[model samples]
Target: MPAIISHDTGTDAAESLVYTSQPPVYTYTTSLISYALPPSQFVTPETPQVAVGAFIFTPPGTSPPKVLLLRRAATDSYPNLWEVPGGGADPEDTTLLDAVAREALEESGLVAATIVEFLGTVEFGTSRGNWCIKYNFLVDVEEGEVTTNPAEHSDGRWFDLEEVRTLAVTTELMRESLVKAFERVEELRRSRGISDPVS
Candidate 1:
């Protein structure tokens, strides 16, 4: 039997994986949907690989702090796997910020009002290739309201860090890294003498 993945926020393991719409066969000129490399191109040992992923957060009358999560659309390679909002970096993207901004707009339809800080980078393997260096960031949304494109995501939700940790759709490494990111955010806030409304 094949491995089943859901990418769903909730725990409902399916017989197949869910993913975003198919990545184009050719890289697009448009920054939003572009690929790291054209499907026909191969990355040689000399070729460097850098990708970006984001942990977008919103403060919604906090009971628990919530971050945006995207459900992977079904696909042959990575059928159903829940992941942070991100994708391959474009050749034209000179900085990680360029890639992060483009991906957030394409995937979540929310623009980063302010780039709070760089969380940290992580190396993760995917079915698509051997390994990728993921650039992670914490973004403040220009407007919290989301306008997601249905073709890319089945559903979108704001999950508290604890709730995210409980989801089976994601990996343990991701949960731990994000929880740490949240802790750092709280620390930064406190150092500035800003208080969490709940406390």
Candidate 2:
């Protein structure tokens, strides 16, 4: 499952809608406390799925090597917890990359230039329920600084990889995914004889 923050800016009707992603097989219902979802849904091996996430990396600038993180505002589920930029894949999205682009634009106001590689998936644990997968990808930020959606996230910051390693990440699965991807990025750079972008 993926959650996003949205607001009505009026320029576009979608700006007013905050979108979330669950397996397409599931339907959402209304509730006074929060949106209601089925207790459990099943997905077949052929079920339609979407990939929606970007592991953003910035070469060391004024700061040491940095990656972006969003602090989720206290709410249902992972309230007050921090996460990388991601959401559900949109129905209209023709490809996983398309879903990734839309989520990045809505949540972080960042545009993607290219997808460097497919890092893989992160499972949040059975406690989070089934019927969903968090697809992670390495995206090259083509341009622009990050401006966050106030509704979904309280703040956004750039943190050194080492720094994030020191923090208490609530989800161990995601932490392992990030660490592996980060190492792969470094390995690629080394294979090409490219120096650390952040250095």
Q: Model 2, residue 75: what's the lDDT?
A: 62
Let me know the TM-score candidate 1 reaches against the reference structure.
0.68
The deviation in Å at residue 26 for candidate 1 is 28
Per-residue lDDT of model 2, residues 71-135, tens digit only: 77666357667678887665566345556656776778776544445677654433334445666
lDDT of 1 by residue, 34-147 (tens): 232342232335334666777776553344566788876664334455667877877665445656666777888776543445667677676666676666766555554555
The C-alpha TM-scores of every prediction are: 0.68, 0.67
Off by over 4 Å in 2: 1-51, 60-63, 125-128, 197-199
| Pairs with steric clashes in candidate 2 | 60-198
Highest TM-score: which candidate? Answer: 1
